[model samples]
Target: MPGGVGYLLQHCGAFFIRRVWGDDLLYNSIMKEYIEILLLRGHNIEAFTEGTRSRIGKLLQPKFGIMKIILEAVLSGRVKDCMIVPMSIGYDRVIETGSYVNELLGVPKEKESLYQLLSNMNILSLKWGRIDISFNKAFSLKEYIGAHTTRRGIPLNPSTSKIDRDLLLQSLGYRILSDINKVSVIMPTALVGTILLTLRGRGVGHDELVRKIEWLKKGIEMRGGSAADFGGKSTGWVVDRAIQVLKDLIGQRTDLLEPVYYPVKRFELSYYRNQVIHLFINEAILSCALYATVKQGGPIHVQRVKINPDLERDCSFVSKLLKSEFIYGPNGLTENMMKSIEDLTSLDVMRIDVENGTDGEVKYLSLSAEERRIGRETFDFFCFLLWPFLETYWLAAISCFALIPQTLPPIEPTWVDERVFLDKAQFLGKTLYYEGDLSYFEAVNKETLKNGFQRLKEMGVILFRKVKKGNENVTMVALSLDWCPKTALPKPPKCSKTGKGSEEVKSNNTIFTSIFGGGKPEPKISLDGTDTPQDYFDETWRYFVPEGKLWELCEQIGRYRREGKNRRDTATVAARVLSLASVTGALLTESDGTGWIKKKTSKL
Candidate 1:
């Protein structure tokens, strides 16, 4: 469709591309020249849709320039019988992924020779699927016009027909889609790879993967694929061919095994896997926003349990950056973002290991300003415009039920969904309790996500169970690994600054929460010496876990301390127990077990 617009003079249509490569303005200029030529040659003017392709698999939002022209022209009687057709072309081997990654990384691609380009084709074999073109039944302009040609035409800028403009775009977009059947290489590979990754974490055999893929291809084929569209020499053959190409690459390199489907190109699997994840992520974003809108709740904010007691030191840096922008005041209107978020039942708060590589496969790894802006914008649109009849509102509530609070692992997809912490009901009698698990919050690749999970285990926030879904499970959403520690020291102060004066209040946020903004997802840390977030609490310690151990020691010595034992002996034992609870805090009293730990340690 991209080059087609460049070549087709008589059949002019809109050009949609991603906002990448700022040459879109030039593309419009070239199109206008070609269109003017065709009109001068007495050919019917084929109007253009000035739009861009989305880098992601979903359709890009259309620009209104072309739509404006079509409306003006049709109303002015500049054209007739403006029949439009929507066509889809699916690629079994997406030529763009290779090019796309290059573009994303700011890598400039060199145009290669015919042989070099062919060698890079990676089509060692391929299964090119048939193109799906939806021929929308044409409608006469008169039907929509609903008005006989007047000396003076209906006003295109009429104030009374504002809703009509929206209705026209929506109706036309869907009508055009009714004719498309093409599946691009990105879509199918994502479908197949996502399934395989889900089922076999290490990967799957080619034959077995193909069987599963065949079932899907065949099913879709039966639904709408004609004999030529698939089956013999069409989409099916192309898909089969694509898989075959992957299998054929086995003998070409020693590193490639007979069953190996890829050469392990640096970003291919990641790019494809991202395509798969984004499908669900996009849906999750849309649905969750809608769910939040109808529920009528306040904005959801999250906090992480602080392992480091150092207040004011580490957070001093983050606090500088931690700011809340008042984009606009909350109102009950469609554009009121805060109010829209307020309507949501819950927020998807995933607990990721910002300290580990938990989120590698995901493309954008951080909670950047751009992402936050998009998130707020998306919430606003869905809450205000989404049809109320849809189950988007209901589904949000149902999803929360799947999350068991406290024990949830903070995986990426788990984010944006409200997390419920499980109660420590089972440990009520045991005054001393301690537990931890690794929770990845950063977006990373498969390797990073795994590494992040393992490392997070060392840092704590551990959960006892794991839940996974789908075939390949690459898109597997994990619980945020929420947990509750028994408060051994029930009367302890609500907040304690590590190494600070006894009267100083610890800030509300902690080192981990401050470093990565608590509401964000798990972090993806790299093992290759990159992305190691500076740890402010690395040397500091929290008393929660340590206090738990102290409680048991207190119970063990309760009788001894209360007995008519020697005062010196009782003080010695009490000092030691209390010493175990102190972390970098200056010794206030001197005792071991019962007394003198502070005086002895300080003297040493």
Candidate 2:
């Protein structure tokens, strides 16, 4: 797969992987046999420590299932003291990013097939850029166990203690993840993506972008990070190459008679941008906080202009705020922020003073002439990076306020399901997205939405409880303010019955719209007089009625399309309807199969 030989070796003549799916239960037994064969037969075994492909572009928290088995074998003396090595492989662009985005949005990932396998072979010809493979430090299992077994609170023999064994495996797994992050490479695609996106769709001219690239090269170099494909080249040359690559994927346009990226391509642009977000996110965050203090007239903005941030407090605040939006290594913000401060100091953007006291108060100062010029161009970049998350937080706060009644009354948190709250947040988030209040890609993200809820919870805006619903217990939230039981527990909007009585409440808008277009329609009319195709699309979704089958939904779409005169664009109409449904927190797959359904908009 790495070298693209899978396309040529159609019959798997010499190259083939014995796949062990992470989702399957019975595969555990197969995996055990596979491992035993490799260990005992003196064969090398390669495994993805992440257990599954990363859907969010960053390394997900490692699953301990496979790691536990491997550790068990070593502890049982089934294999000799094996050398454990951590390796990381990164691509400038991944082939599965589009499908990954869908899966992350809660769509069921389609099962892989032979036809799909052959279809993906087309990626071999694409300009995917370079592959970076980095090998990290190796450690032996014997040495690892020997060093960890005698920890103060751990038992002497892990075999006799399940808790001790589990802890040891978890610690080892985290170590491997840390090693993986250390070796990850930075690619030009990610660099370019970050630069363009930082502009927030306000396209930058060629000369200006090249200058920004030079500034980034210096910043990255100061942090001792590698930029792939940038070896020994002038910044202008590298920027030109990167822009050409982006143009190949998303066509270019001229804005104000200067070469600029197409703004509408930001979604695709964000994917590549996210690939390198981890490397400099902490630095960007620190810069923002300091700059905000200076701009907003704090002690830092005073005559001396040396900033003193409550290191632990400010860093943790920013980290929690951006946790969902950015991918970070295992290190906490405290440690990472300190490192960032040091990097910025070296870059001459900050300074640390120890002469006044031993605490080493950090000071922020205006950049040098050249540096100030760079900062001016990139100031909005920092603003764009943090704007969406701040908007999400405000949206969540508004939702909580709207849910609560004005009069004070005591109420428990168990009335509202946490899952339902998240659903509502995303649905309303899309509303805000359409209103131009939320970023395009961040609007539908579940994790970011969850972070918004969490931030509100921490701020005492909402309190939560665990409530038993059906066979499972769900986390529920309620306003921390006074509760009026009658109105506090809101239900889904009561949809009136229309059109067919016996069959579902599907609408026949042709006659109603034809008649109503020339006159005022009744208030209770299913098809509003001013309704356009978009309004109809929004209204038809309510017929989903919380849940239904995929085929049944398709049939409903067919009925709706048949009512209209435009039959030529059925496929496009069908896809748009379904996509809108998904974004609005209405459509989802059935638990056990390929069937699809809609989720309730509010509690009932």
Candidate 3:
């Protein structure tokens, strides 16, 4: 709602105006009218590039729908070329982070309501850290288009279905994300989270933890990124404040006179750490991989480990291996790796051989063995960040490849529902997590598996279909390749009773395959023995009459009181009900955020 003063001004006809929902962009009439009205009045327009708040902390890839509208307006001559300014706001603590975490864990976001609004007012009393705002210099769309003009004077139009226009948009999107990361606020809580998470929840001694924080702070600053205040305070003092911030602001306990993770708060810790991971991720990847390569036998590293990376070749190889794990720009892995290598060189983390070439090939120095022995913790932290992703990808690849036909079958199934594929992926993911093959942040993350599927899809390693299944159309993802032996791909070695050195070596060699590169049981059985969670959700849903809120109403049905029942248990029940309702025709979630059982389709 508009403020009273603004309403009064509007009543007095200060200016002609109308509020338009983002949904209006979906219709051609609405888009034309909105564009015509804005152009007629020469009004400034604003839109969120990401469309919505990121469920995960990083800047999401910008939605092209709104961008398409503006591009169409310019191309159609409905509006003149305008200056597009990219603005980014970084918060030390996001107001909706709790909801975001839940959503990331598969819980649907609760619909906005007055009660929720009032409930959140308590946040006003909480101490959220600073907000940093950054505005990039405006660039003219006309100039951008003109630069890509052909000799015949034809301007670049996204509507033209040209490769050039697609490339331009991709570049623009990456540029915007890069700008947002540049202005990201590096709070003490974020730093502390990074250390604890990277160390795999291990405690660091007081002096060691303090030194790590200082080292990290200096690295972030050197890269032109901001860190929470460290000036005029002793190292110990800064460390104490960081610990307090973690406890008071985030409710994490890291002070045992040593920094350690609180098991219950690991997810929250990861969220904070992710905010700054991109800053040093590249260096971490390089240094970690190199360190692992050098300390081969004692640790019994993977066979693929390269003890000495040939500057250009091996850097590119490692970067490609890490593609699914990190966000990369349109310039792609090679260029990004080269830039990271240059940065590492500048930081004195590692040096390149400038004076002499090794037998007509490029050569560079790895960190000294002494340093690796001392900095073992630091490298492990970096490598661990990539561990979950690699493990999840490996699980998906192994599972999917196993499904492929080793011998010719009578018939090949064209597709499997996307959900079924994901269920299998999640089951395997959960198994790996339980076996300690995955990281804390990724243990229950089906989204990571989805990404792995997407990467495989993009590479033609897998295929999918949209088909009518009962009353609904479902997506079915399938492998494109025939089955092959485990030996052909990277596989973990068989476990032995003694667990010799080779066994340890084999254990460390994890595998990954990605298209994007980038659970529970019930004992309840009804008379028909078809009592799945979906059935329970369907039956219980009827008690709420016309519609029920999945979260609030389900809580009552399940008798989940906040006091005694764990939040995760309640959250899991709610998430599972919603998931079941979505898959079967049990319930339909409306735009108004209420769930109603579908007519004549209650049973599943």
Per-model TM against the reference? 0.37, 0.64, 0.67
Task: Estimate the lDDT of model 2.
Answer: 0.54
Please report the TM-score between candidate 3 and the true structure.
0.67
- For residues 1-604, could you state the per-residue lDDT of candidate 2 as single tens digits? 5345566664553434345354566767777766765677776557678777765556655667656767877888887667778898877777776676665454566877667778878778877667889888998876788788865454567666888888788778777876776667767777777787776335777787787777766656655566675678877787667666666445456645877654445655666765555566776666555544344333432512343444445446666655545556556666777787776667555655443546654544443344455554444455455554455554554445334432235333223456545555555555445534344545456655566677656755567666556776566666655322232221112223244322232323332233223344422322211111132333433433322232232232222111112222234343343333333222111112222233221232
Lowest lDDT sum, 10 consecutive residues, model 2, at: 525-534
Query: Distance (Å) between predicted and true CA of 278, model 1?
Result: 12
Error of 1 at 84 (Å): 0.8
lDDT of 1 by residue, 378-399 (tens): 3332222211111111111111
> Which predicted model would earn the best lDDT?
2
lDDT of 3 by residue, 2-77 (tens): 3565677667645432333434445656666765577558767676777777655656656665566666677667
Off by over 4 Å in 2: 1-37, 104-111, 119-123, 147-159, 230-237, 248-251, 254-257, 288-311, 320-335, 351-423, 447-604
Model 3 segments beyond 4 Å from truth? 1-26, 147-159, 228-242, 248-264, 288-295, 298-335, 342-348, 351-359, 362-365, 399-410, 441-443, 469-472, 482-604
